[model samples]
Target: MRVSGSGAGSMWLQLLLSLAALWLSDANEPGTAMTTRDINQQTRESISDYTVKGHDLSTSGSHLTTQDFKQQTEENISNLTSAVYSISIDGFSSAPVEENVILYSPANIALLCSLTGTSTDSATVNVTWKKDNERVESSNVTINETKNVLSTQYTLTIRDRNQMGNYTCVFKSDQEVKATFNLQVPQIEGKEHHVVSYVGDSVVLVCKSLKYTPINWIWYMSNGSDQVAVNDSLMPDKYIVDEKYANITKLKIMKISEKDDRSYWCQAVFKLGESKGKVSLKVLTYMTPLKPFLAIAAEVIILVAIIFLYEIYSKKKQMHAGTISCFFK
Candidate 1:
């Protein structure tokens, strides 16, 4: 078999071209090679039928169902809203001495307290309510026992200033456990808590309450980090406690010195607890406000003296020049 070289070369070239044509046909065929968009579309379709724990995924691939997500959101919002008006206390020991303080403003606000008992026997557990250590008679309290757990709830309404006091929840069982809620009015703060006065000047620090008439008014001065009670008997010439009215109390600081420049606290003792307001006293010399004017006046005097000296020097030079011209003539 004697084949020519040109014919063999031509046959090899035709075979290569035929193989390339077959590859190109297969690449263009439908569903043989997928574009990026086609692959993403198929992936989305397959994910739509997927399930986990018998719960179908949403169209957007979110695992939570519509109703479940909505209910969870509502429950979270409800919990946050109720937390503002309710207070919960639990885990009481045999000897409970810590008191929780709750401050309320001058408004008709109702406070809800939920108390849980730690006793195993719910049958022998009893709860009682007291205000300032006196028995409270009200129909707004409820007690429930479920699954050997004893719980009680008390609702107190503050309609007037006199109703603010210490509320105690006493749990009686094999041992008595008590928890106190010291309910008091918030301390009234004035527009200016700072008072500026000169040294050796008598200044009065005042604290007043419009709604509450405290049982007693006491004044304290800050000594370093501790508050020492201001006793008129001890420092008779310095401090004088005066009550202008039933609600207004004044502490007159006679001959206030630089050492008296500190925070003074005025505490109003009520039946429930004590509320204290802070008043800061700032002592300065009488020349403190005039310091800026004094600096300006000194600068003006120095400048005027400089201008006057320059004028005198100019006049002396002119007289010397006239005498030299006459000598030259």
Candidate 2:
């Protein structure tokens, strides 16, 4: 279904009302969808359904599904006609991949795959990947009577890079059962959010998107997924929102104190993906901790040195005056 909006205020009101009615009537209930642009955003504010309960892991964002895994498992029989594949970043691969595959940046071309055929009791399979029809990476795997399924991982990071196009993964068997998957590369965009904090209190980090741009923002901890608050009462005073550029996000601290000095994060969402930035706050103090003792010591040294210098000068003046008087006599 398509949704469009116009400049009229009454039209927006009517649209909201209709959306609410439609959400109440959906089969999966009110808050089940994992999209940002659903028409009934007012009714689906919280993500309670998406939260985990004990050991139950929900596969919401992962591209593969439980049914997909089961189908792949079933396809692998005595003949071993199926393969399971995955791709990721550096140091995460089980085996060595080529250097060009490792050094590929976002400015390069999209990842591609090619398949070839051979017939024997055992077959040697060479898989090649390319960008713009030019070969970039190639790997070889063998399949025989004893082995059927070949599982390999190619470590490559692809997100918000300069390259944009459709990526493909191809698998060819000794027989004619070949499989392919089309993966569209994601694009990158800049996003910024505003956060305010205060001392002896709570703070809400507002991840505001660029004005008139469509993006999704999520707040979470560094080690875990607990959603941090962006409201005022949780932070301390003496905190100032560092509003530098138009993209500057501020943290308002209330009742500034030592407890408020900690690591805080701001995650900005873009159409391509998400990126995070961090800030550290140190509470301000009136004077240095050892300043009082150091100040007294400095004053005593200054007084003694001034007295010693004055005595030396007075003696020298007395000698000079006596010499002058004696010469006249």
Candidate 3:
């Protein structure tokens, strides 16, 4: 009777244990827990929401595993580089828990790339140019590991006039990731010319260019080889230009004389160029023969009238003297 009771208890216990095992096995099925993909998707959605609001989403995209977080962050870095912008690791994933950023003027250089995905606090970034395939420059930054993000800025100045190229940034955190961009400057061109006239006469020698470019204008006369007249006010031998829409330059002959019959030139100076033009001058010429002929005629008339008057006076004097003598006798 004792053995049968013991057997029956054992059987009951075994059946109960079997039933418990089945229940536990059902609970431990393979598809029961949420997958890494699901967590990553959720993190990305949440991160997107935070980014739209201009809020710090760097810490919001924390996935279940560090690998997923790092992978997502690297992908985001690639996208940011394509858009010419940078994103905090918090906006990407919650892995490594540390971040670094590089600010570049050219923004698309190798140094910028090396700085990406790494802590900015104590890392050296290598720089290179695509055309030259040569090393350009490098930089270092200090960063905190636990911090979700860190950043540094770099400015580039162009010193060469002929240098032409785009700037690129290569971001490198602990991972090997990168981004790129382009830079450009303006080109300049210029020229100048002028027209000039003498004083007391209206002149229209200078015509400014139609292109409204900023420039400096000057009026001058080219007297000799490489010689220019620079007097703004009229001098004894110089001409002053009047400020008018016509850009009239005048050469004043206070007393116009034969010496005033020289060519007057006008010169203009612009920002990056210069030019000059001259106008021929002529003095009022007098009739050489007419003046001398008139003078001779006047002299001959005066002499004839004088002679007639002298004879008349002498005859009257003689007659008076004779009459007086006769009376006296």
Write one digit per residue (lDDT tens) for candidate 2, span 160-229: 5333332333333343222222333222123333333444554533333343222433333333445464
lDDT of 3 at 281: 51
TM-score of each: 0.43, 0.29, 0.24
What is the Cα-based TM-score of model 2? Answer: 0.29
Q: In model 2, which regions exceed 4 Å deviation?
A: 1-109, 112-125, 128-227, 232-248, 270-273, 289-329
Model 2, global lDDT: 0.44
Error in Å for residue 34 of model 3: 82
lDDT of 1 by residue, 25-49 (tens): 9788976876789889998877765
Quick one: best lDDT, which candidate? 1
Model 3, 182: alpha-carbon shift in Å? 31
Report residue 146 deviation for candidate 2 (angstroms). 36
- Please state the error at residue 140 of candidate 2 in Å: 17
Off by over 4 Å in 3: 1-214, 222-226, 233-238, 246-253, 288-329
